[model samples]
Target: MAKGIRFHYLHRDSGNYKKFGHRDFSNPNNLTVEEITQRIRQALIDTEFFYPEKVGIPKFLFHRYGDDFSWYEFESVEEIQTHYLHESIEGFIAKLLRDG
Candidate 1:
């Protein structure tokens, strides 16, 4: 009963996309959303994608597909460090670009 989560990020210059995820949940039903988010954040940080002076918060999104197909948009480094729920990344980005 392992839950799956995937991370997608776009390279600003190259316009290429990168993806990552975990499949073995060990007991997805027992895990909370916060725990899942923490693991995702840790994995991204380990990749040096959140370095302040370097890349900062990479333009990334996370998706949990299947029964619970959801999308998450990373706003900032601080926001990613905290736990939150998933929304539509594409919609969020569109709104930001349109409104701001």
Candidate 2:
């Protein structure tokens, strides 16, 4: 089987980056969307459990709250096949069960 890809979700944790670090997401001075996204992608790779297709980061917060990360699980990649255009965690799980 081809290895699954992990996707990391991200957002500001604090008002500024002082508590976290210079490159922290919460830092007002650190306004780099590409850099932030890159960090998230890196985190996902480090974790290596979640799949990118099943994960999403909406332009606007879907479940607006603290921490700014959410995750779903799958048994196989087929569960994630149709999510490119229209995907959700629930669909991913359902498709996973349906395929197997």
Q: TM-score for all predictions?
A: 0.24, 0.22
* TM-score of model number 2: 0.22
* Top candidate (lDDT): 1
Best by TM-score: 1
Q: Residue-wise lDDT of candidate 2 within 1-100, one digit each (tens)?
A: 2222222233332332211111101222322444433433334434223333343322332434555443322221111112133333333334323331
> How high is the CA lDDT of each candidate model?
0.32, 0.30
Model 1 stretches with alpha carbons more than 4 Å out: 1-13, 16-24, 46-100
Candidate 2 off by > 4 Å: 1-25, 46-70, 73-100
lDDT of 1 by residue, 1-100 (tens): 2233333433222222334322111222434545545544544433323322132233235323333212223322211232333433333223333332
| Candidate 1 structure, TM-score to reference | 0.24
